[model samples]
Target: MTKRRGERPPVPEALPAPVVDAHTHLDACGARTPEQVREVVDRAVEAGVDRVITVADDLDAARWAAEAATWDDRVFAAVALHPTRTSTFGEVEQAELARLAGQPRVVAIGETGLDYYWDYAPRSAQHEAFRWHIDLAKRVGKPLMIHDRDAHDDILAVLDAEGAPDTVVFHCFSGDLPFARACVERGFVLSFAGTTTFRNARALREAARWVPEDHVLVETDAPFLTPHPYRGRPNEPYCANYTLRDMATLRETDLGELATKITRNAERVFGLRDAAKS
Candidate 1:
């Protein structure tokens, strides 16, 4: 079913336990202000999605994400220059990102990595920025959240070459079973987004089932992949419940049990010790 513009799907029944949206872009979802962020997060909470890591795609977005985290305890930030925007990466942007990455609210250095599907930046420039972000994640001792598109091979190769961070997550993972196995073998966490619920994403569903409970994660990637039945609509964290429920069905596990597992996995990867406090 296609979603109408400016329309949002109804919130699904809340899960037995809260689940974290491993990655989302609150700012892109039009939650640019503190009040707007709270509104969105509140709705998410009601749907059993209590925490989210809002990721930035550029310098301006990075600034907004870091600031947004301070507005609500349920929100955390991941700052980086997205692979598509790497064409503009330089000393000034890098320095600013480094500053944001050090903030207490900034828990990850990511939404970085390769996106070969878009030629917004040259391959060389994207590679350079990916290496830099990888190093930054390592230096900050934070997990690296990747945005791999059609460039899976290069994404893995670069991470291997740079010696990946202590923890790495493939945000909105779109790979097949073999690729999923490769990532899991390297100890990388795979975050399944709304796309996993789509009927056309058979391979992705297979990969989701293949992943171990500890290595699996869930996200909305909101305002983008809005999950099945609500595909093409504007998405928000609250909609994560749909994806979580679908994942549980795919794994043949109890929804509540899976929610608990995904939440625990998120806490571990993002080092969110105070997650429950929020």
Candidate 2:
């Protein structure tokens, strides 16, 4: 099918088994209103993506993500200020995030690590904000979602200094095998995005191929990283199946089995089923 309006790529075919998009941005995917969010999630469901965890990148997004999760049973939320937006992290922002993080629908405290790629926030501010988020995650007993961009060493260092959370997920994991091994050894989950499908992301592919089933999860990180063949196009939760297929091929495993394992990993890390029961 041709690209949709806004150059959105067509949703990929459904996987054999249901899968969860462990990370994505419903707001960035052009789904803000409750109806829009539900529409977007429904599209993903049609593609066999059973659930999605919409991630927040700032204070406003944190609020939106929290409420958006309540909009649909299939939608969950992760709240945190993006490292690039840490320049303004203060008492007010922290308080709001803490409140939002406590929401029943909020599953993780994340997308909060360091991002050396963007000079938007100074290193000092990023470090301070990152530490605060780490502490919050620890207190809340939720997984810490990291957004490591060209700051792998520092990211790991900060997590160590702050005492890493019980469940730490490297969102859009942009690390090589060595770093991946280090995270795995520490019992951190690596959530792969569309980048794993990029032909040039051999190092990332290696990490994805080798990460044990129990420690792995999949995400879209969309309306960005649209996966191979659709790279540069707008992305949404539905596109996760494409990345799953690629990873299955890369790992030389059955597509359905890999899908099941990844979904289960997501469930365990985010306590999805438990949250629903409560």
Best by TM-score: 1
For residue 120, give model 2's deviation from the true position in Å: 0.6
Candidate 2 residue pairs in backbone clash: none
Q: List the candidate 2 regions with Cα displacement exceeding 4 Å.
A: 1-6
Provide the overall lDDT of each model, using Cα atoms, as 2-decimal numbers: 0.92, 0.91
| Residue 62 in model 1: lDDT | 94
For residues 79-143, write the lDDT of model 1, one tens digit per residue. Answer: 99999998888999999999999987799998999999999999999999999999999898999
Per-residue alpha-carbon lDDT of candidate 2 for residues 79-188, written as tens digits (9 for 90 to 100): 99999998888899999999998987899998898989989999999999999999999888999999999999999998888899899999999999999999999999
State candidate 1's TM-score: 0.97
Predict model 2's lDDT versus the native.
0.91
Give the distance in Å from residue 222's predicted Cα in candidate 1 to where it truly belongs.
Answer: 0.8
